[model samples]
Target chain A: MFDLSTPQRQSKKVIALYAFKSLRGFIFFFVFAAFGMRGFLEGLAFTGLVLFVAATSLIGPVIQYLFFKFHIEQDEFILNKGWLFKEKKAVPLERIQSVNLEQNLLQRILKVYSVQIETAGSKEKELEIKALDESAALSLKQALLDISNQREEQEKTEVTEPEKKTVNPTSNEVSSTLLKLSFLDLFKVGMTQNHLRSGGVAIGLVVGSYFKFQDVIKQFFGDYLDGWEWENLMSFASLGMLFSFLLIFLVFSIVVSLITVFSNYYGFKAVVYQSHLELSMGLIKRQEIRVPIEKIQSLEFRTNPLRQWLGYSTAYIYQAQSDANKASKVSIPACKKEHIKILQETAFKDSVVDATIDIPCNGFSYMRLASYIMLATLIPTLVPLAYFGDYNWVVPMLIPAVVIVFWSYMYGSNSGIVTDKGFIGFKKGWLFKSFSISPVFKAQAVEKWDSIFIRRREEMHVKFHTASGSNGLRYFKKDAVNHLLNYINNTVIKSNRNWM
Target chain B: MTNEQILTHSLPDIESFSFEKHPKRFLNKKLIANTLYMIPLAIAVGFLFYNFSEFPWLGWSGLGLWAFILLFSLFVNYKEYFVRGYTLREHDITYRKGWIFHHQITVPFNRIQHTEINHGPIDRLFNLCELEIYTAGGSSSDLSISGLDPKDAQNLKSFVAGKTSTHV
Candidate 1:
């Protein structure tokens, strides 16, 4: 649902940069261009691909720069824009939540910023103007803020209009509003990320990048890579095996960890306003998101297995009304490192401890099948070993199988619980970084899932449903789950409170 | 001034909120017809499975699941079929609903941001409408009466939304 308002503008360059960042397909493009061309068919494919990219790249920018136009009338911003179905949005100044400025490196280089005006707080982004005049963006933001302040004053205190202060936004840019983090701050971040999330963030990056680059890798062991070969295949196979063991496997992990370090990079600053908050982040490609104060539904603090080990917890703000589902609208995604503590100290200055119940380690060994997924290697390798009778395929499977068994044993051993006298937490994500935290009052529904198998073992999946989202504790110590559930279910029922 | 006399309108005879009334419809026939048009396609799917699905297990399973699902939906709706009463209190509006799982939701007039009167083809057939009261909380905490006569629904919405004037 779009607001029928004043001005409308054209295509955004930031979106183009984001679309191009899908590095997976870009790797394939190089492969397709380098050697896989089939002369005439190749020429046709290349020509079509070039034309398609050109048209798409041109359409977004053209619509943003030319067709979109917006202007402010007496009390609202009127936006008009359309490529096919002409749409006009009227966003009343009173309904405006936050007016944010977004400029990526490309936008910054081009000396332009896209403006997003959101009101109903349904995670829709509600993009208003792209490639806007920076001065216009500033003035419009100030105008909305000024109107909100006036309305709040009138609505809350029942006061008459006070003389409006002419805000010179250009001159006020230097007031400690900008927060920048440097290399020293990275150390604080490093200290907060325990071995788990760091390893998870690392291994996930490595594995993801390695699989992504599989298309580019032609011959790892020359001819010995697929079938049975001897002669110099042994020499090359040894070399390739060494290369994987040393460089591709080990060094790749380091590279992936480094990439994750940049991906989770946060020079995050929430520019707090009277009624709205503007969030700016990104080290390479900067982005600013604005969330209205009223749209925030519920807030939670969670510690991944890593952060918990490091004695740190992260604060996440769950907002209502995204373009689609409300459960997934996380505006203030986890504050980096000690910033969570700072957030709790400042942003949640008047809050009590959320969950008194200690985190529970749900002892579910079956879940480790994902972490130790190399067990499937035997099936693929066995098929080839039986049909082709080649022992070479079996070696690749053995290496992964060993790693999988080790992974399963380690994950299984680490599964344990530390429940408190009051709240309850369930840990489940992966071996790298599991999420576990729960607040008592927030749990809306408690469900016990028992299939025929689970009931035999006297174990069940306990689901704790908060209004927006629910996390299920799978195969927990049934005695503990049942006991806490009984007490919690009773407490919630006894108290006459508005739940639904 | 009574609470329902939100904004003064020409005084029309005020009717006490009742559980009994000839249901007036709020919805256009086009929407209901479009929704009802899907039944044939569902029958066609069952027919296609019965005739063409080479695998007997697949055909039987598909038809069985559809039958079960259709039956379950009917059961839920049958239990929920309700006619609720709505009235204007001194400072608030009260709506009582629920055939099986009953509820009486109350909304203060001052807290109401807007009011809506909606109807579908089924509602139109029975001369009924769904009257909704909106507030800040996105929760279904707002009062919704599903089976009100069209005129009563309009009057309730107009009255609650502060469009009703006593002068009418």
Candidate 2:
């Protein structure tokens, strides 16, 4: 009963979105053109140019949208577009990894959303319908998933038991909201944030811009500065001025973090459907992301010192499909502690503690790390100290060395753990700690490396590679690496779990 | 149960696993490739030595270091032929290589995204090819076992493909 020949176009709302995006891209050009214009003829020419550019941009999307059409074939989903180029691409339904629906404020207002189709065969989004009616988008996703599921069932040679519940693609079942961040939660996340890091970033930005500002000043007041003796400027570099500058920078960073957190995470909510987890956040854009439960690779529970003290931890669910343009690993930031446990339960569906094998960090490891750090810094500092012929330089060098040593000691003392039952679990982090749990069945590859340096200490570095990404523990005892590698490999070989 | 017995049954030792050595002629192929690469590098070093001949010891030491490195690499290449091997189990494959800094990589068939057979002009002359198995995460193959007879590589590829098709 399914007709495979007909092609369809996206909703007309995409035209406005595309035109708006194109107009936004011209802001820099407009600024530069306005700055360069001085005469009446030039202003007239600029106005004409703006009109011409706007017309061209507007016409492009209209023509492309008219030509763009997608069809659902028997075995593949085919998309054809581009009036001049006439491009056609067909993606096998079996290769389709995920279908994600996203909506911005404009899209929501227009009653349309974008559908991004990701395939495992390529890193990029294989297909994107820029705008579709909300119900249409959901139906498209459901149809694609159902087709894939049908193909999978057909490929299974063995006769298995029938599914307990048949999922209706067009069901009107509503999902329960798991967690939503209130204004107070956002405040906590902002307060418990790393103030020093953002402060350092602000300081770096100022320092970098200082040279450009100096160039501008030289252009304007070069002769004046040359004639004046500028020795007095060094007086402002005193310790008290430095401390106040740092305090101001810290305050500035705190303010920036609060503003950023509030704006980005405004109305943040996580919801659980039958087969997917939807995360909606952002104030201006109102970003919505759908992460399929099956595509999730690992669950990471992260807690910094302040968050630990505040009794809350951030959670991240790393998935297999990377976002179309931004290759960033998406994380659920500032999740409540109870929410973290619920997320783990939903993802793993089993007990967590029983599968853990904790590797205790001992004093010897700390001593080893300290010695390595000292030896690493000693050679670089010696030459500068000797050339300066002053012992004061050595003190400055030792400051960084001591801080590094202390950090190393802290990191070394923190225990590492790995466990495997239904899923593979690993825990790490000293100051900013995290526990990563990935399904054991999805273990793609396991590797062990024993470099000459590690070989001397009778240790090996082991890495566990999953579909999403790889994470590992370094400087473990050689036997431990061997054991971990064997366990993962054996499990992968013997288990009947379907990673796809 | 004794600890030894428990260890023997529970843990699959890397040393105990039987690994198939690559064809011996692969060493000749490696030497030719090395010589082709070293000729230009040696010429560049010689030109540098000629330009800075005023410091004769510098040139001599530079040449000595280059010669030492060339010889050491050749020896290591030869040694790797014996040590570098791959093993195919029921559902997974393992490739081991390197002498000083040893490494072993094991990849399950279900995790393999795809497999590729690659060969160069020299490799064709030697009737050898490389089998590269790629995973989902990255651009690079998870395991690339070079220096295989074309037929053998094809067989392995098909075997892996069959396993992956069934499992994935």
True contacts kept of 1: 0.00
User: What is the iRMS for every candidate structure?
Assistant: 15.0, 5.3
Task: Give model 2 RMSD, 1 decimal.
Answer: 4.7
Q: Candidate 1's error at A77, in angstroms?
A: 2.1
lDDT of 2 by residue, B8-112 (tens): 224546444567888877989998788777887788778878998888887778788789988988988887777688877777788888877778888878778
Which lDDT tens digits does candidate 1 get at residues A1-500? 12224453433553454344443455567566654664745666778876776565656555544656777788877777766778777777776756667776677776777676766534344645656556666666677666765665465343222342333323323333323445544444444444444556767867799777655554354355556556666767676687776655554544554444444556766655544456677665666766554444444555555555555445565443433444334333335554543433343232334333242433344444433455464676588687987877677767766766666555544443334433444444344544343445344444545544445565655655444455564555556665665455444433332221
Q: Against the unseen true structure, what C-alpha lDDT does each candidate score?
A: 0.52, 0.74
Chain A TM-score for each candidate, in the given order?
0.57, 0.84
Please give the range of 10 consecutive residues that has the lowest summed lDDT in model 1 chain A. A169-178
- With candidate 1 superimposed using the best TM-score fit, by how many Å does residue A41's alpha carbon deviate from the native? 10
